[model samples]
Target: MFTGLIDKLKGKRTAAVKTPEIMGLRLGASFELDPLAIRLILDELTIESCSPTQIIRAAGLVELDGTWVYRFYTDDDAWLQVVAEGGQTDEHVVDVKLFHFYDTLDVAGQQAWDRLLQREIGAASYSLRERTYGRVWTSAGDYHNPVHMAEKTYDGDGEHSLTDQFTMLFERPLSDQRTESLFLSAEEKQEQAGYLSRSLVISTGITLTPSQLTIHG
Candidate 1:
C-alpha cells in the first residue's frame, strides 16, 4: 500500500515548476541572466510541495486533454493569455492575447481609443513589435499608451490614468532599459527579430512554484 501511494503521488506531479527564477525570466524584460540577482530572488521564494492539479489550478494553468492554458495579469490591468500544447518545442507555439480594460478609461479617452480602432489606425497582427513591450496597438504605438496615461489627469485633478494606477499597484517599473538593445549586436535585422521573439516569450509571465517530475511513454 505504501508503494502504491508513492506511485500515485509521483503520478500527480506535473512536468512544470514555478520558481522565482523562472518567474523573473518570464516577467522580466531581459533574457540575459544576472546569476547573482537570480540567485538572490530564488533564495527569497518560499518552496512548497503540491500536486500538479493543485499547482496548476492555483497558477491558472488549466489543462484540457493535451493542451495547457495559462493566464497572466499585467501591470496595466491588461490580461495576457498563453496557450501551449504538449511536446511543442517552438516559442511560436504559444498563443498570446492582450485583453485591455477599456472601461477603466474615461469617456473622452475611451472615445479617442475607439476612434483609432474604428479607423483601423493602429491595429497590428502582433501585440508587440520586435522591439517594444506591452500592448503595442493604439494611436501612438508601443509604450505610448502608458506614457499618455501618465500625462493625463482625472477630471483635470492631476491624477494619473488607469494604466498608471495599476503600474503602481503591481510595483512594476515603467521601463526596463537593461535588455533594450540586447539584440543590437546581431549582424542582421532577422537575427535581431529572432532574438526579440524568444525574449518576448520569456518575459511574458512568471510563476512561483516548484518543478515536478513526470514519466512519459
Candidate 2:
C-alpha cells in the first residue's frame, strides 16, 4: 500500500508530520534488523489506523507496558504523535524503531515544526478538537489533541455516504508559550524565554539532547 505519501514529501509528511518515518518494511524486520526495532504488535487488529496517544492510553488502561517503543511523527512541535497502520495489507511493519525510538517523553526542543508541516498539506481538510482540555498535547502521554484530517472523499453517489477521511491526521497548534513580564530586566526576560518550549514527544536515538527537527522555508 505504498501511497508515495512520504516518498513525495520533503519533510512535512503529516500530523505536522508525523506527525512518521514512513519506512519500507522488508526482510530486515524478519531476519537482520534488531528485534528491538519492533514497537506494538496487533493481533485482532480491529483498527485500520490509530494515533500514538491512543496506543499510550490503551496501554495504561490494559496495563500493557514496554521499554521497546518509539515515535515516528508529530505535527505540533513534535508534541502529539499520530499513528495509524491500516493501509499496509502486506502486514510487515515490525520493530519500526528503525525510524526512531521511544523519546516523546522528553520536552526539550519542542517548537515550530508544525509550521513547516502544515505547509506541505494544503488546506483541504476538516478538524475536530478535544471537547475538554482547552490545551493540546505535546507528547505521547498527554491529553488527546485536535486533528485535521486530509483528503476528503465520498462513497457511492457522493451525497448520502460521505465520511470524513483520516488517512493523515494533522494536529492543530496552540498559542506559543512565552514569559509574560513588563517589569523584569531584559536579561531576566531573555532567560525566562529560554525556558519556554513546545511540547516534545520525540528525541535523539538515545540521548538527552533533543532531536533537532529539520524545517523548510
Candidate 3:
C-alpha cells in the first residue's frame, strides 16, 4: 500500500485528493509518495499494486523564487501540492511537500494519523502563537523542518498575557524562505517566555523490508 499504509480512497484521487475528516498534520503518517517518482501520490492502494500508478498534468505554479510548483486537484477540502525547482517536472526534484487539510475527523481516523507520526517523527519539536499556530516539523527534533506539528489545543490566545512569537530559521533550502526573516529582521527579544526547542530532528527512510509498519482500514 502507500509506503506502508493499506488505506484507500473511494473516488479517482487527483493531484487534489479528497480531503479526509482527519487534520493536515495527522495525514503525514497516512501519506507516502516515493521521492523518486514525480506523479500522483497515492489515492488508493490496490491489493496487487501499492505504488503511485497515476500521472497528472502540471498546474504551472511557481513559488518562493523562480521555483515551479505543481499543485494537484483534490476535493475542495483537502489539498496536497508538489513544488519543485527549475520547472523540472521530472524526477530531479530537490524539494517535495505534501499537505493534508481535511474536514474534522472522527476519533478513529484522527488517532490513526497521530499514531503514525508519533511512530515516525518523535513528536512536534516545538510550538508557537498567542493562539497556538501549531506548526509541525518533519525534523527529528528541529522545528525548521518543512513539516510543522499540529498542536493538541489552540488556546494560543494571550488570555494570560500578550505574547510575542519567536520563529527559528534555517538559511535557505528547498521550498520556503525561513532563515532570512528572523536573522535579517529581529530587533528585540523577550526575557520571560519559556521556549526551549526539543531542538530535535528525526529522519527515517523506506526500503524493501518486510518489517515496514502498515496501517490497514
Candidate 4:
C-alpha cells in the first residue's frame, strides 16, 4: 500500500512541472534581495534533516506559466511598467518620450515645441532613429491613454505624437568636433556614449541597482 501511494505522488509531481510558451514578455519593478531561511518542503527532506532555504528578490523576475520575465533596472529607479521589454539599450538612440522636459514643459513651451515640430521655428530637440531591438524605452511611438475614473474610452485633447520623437542630443556640438562622430576612430568617442548614458541616469536620480539575472527552465 505504501509503494502504491508513493507511485501516485510521483505522478502528481511530474504533472505539476510544465514548459511555458511565451508570446511576449513584460517586466515589473525591481525589489532588493530578501534572503530568508525557512523550512524545507522538498520530498527528499524531512524536518529533522532539512536544509535552510533563502529567498532572494533581486531583478524582479516573475514566472507566469513557467515562463520567466525579468525587470530592467538602472541606478535611480526600476523601469515602471506592467509589461515591458526593458529600457533603452543605446543612449545615442533615445525615445523622445523619455525626456522629462516634455511632461514638465509649460503651456508656452509646449506650444513652442509644437511650432518647432511644424518647422515654424528652429530649435534642437531630443531625437533618434527607431531601433528594432532594445528595451521598451527605445520605442515611444505609441501614446498610452490615461484611465479616466469618470468615464470609459475618454481620450482627452490631443494624443502624444511620435512623429518628432527621434533627434540627436548633441547635434551641433558633435558636428563641430570630429571627436563626436560615430565613425570617428577615437576610442574616446566610443566611450562618450556610455558616459552620457550613465550621466543621464545619474541626473535623473535613477539609483543604479546591481545586476541580477535568474534563469529557470
Candidate with top TM-score is: 3
lDDT of 4 at 204: 12
Model 3 Cα lDDT, one tens digit per residue, 25-95: 11222333453322221222111123332222112232446454433322222223444566454453454
**Deviation in angstroms for 187 in model 2?**
29
Task: Give lDDT tens digits, candidate 1, residues 129-190.
Answer: 33342233344442222111111112112222211111100111122221111100001112
Model 1 quality (TM-score): 0.23
Better of 1 and 4 by TM-score: 1
- In candidate 3, which residue ranges exceed 4 Å CA deviation? 1-60, 102-217
Identify the candidate with maximal lDDT: 1
lDDT for each residue of candidate 4 in 106-204, tens digit (9 for 90 to 100): 223444444433441112223323211111122243321111111011011211111111211222121222111010000011133343110111111
Worst lDDT 10-window in candidate 2: 180-189
Question: Which 10-residue window of candidate 3 scores lowest in summed lDDT?
Answer: 179-188
Per-candidate clashes come to 1, 20, 26, 10
Q: After best superposition, candidate 1 residue 72: deviation in angstroms?
A: 2.0
Better model by lDDT: candidate 2 vs candidate 4: 2
Give the clash count for model 2.
20
lDDT of 3 at 117: 39
What's each prediction's TM-score? 0.23, 0.16, 0.24, 0.19
Which 10 consecutive positions of candidate 4 have the poorest summed lDDT?
180-189
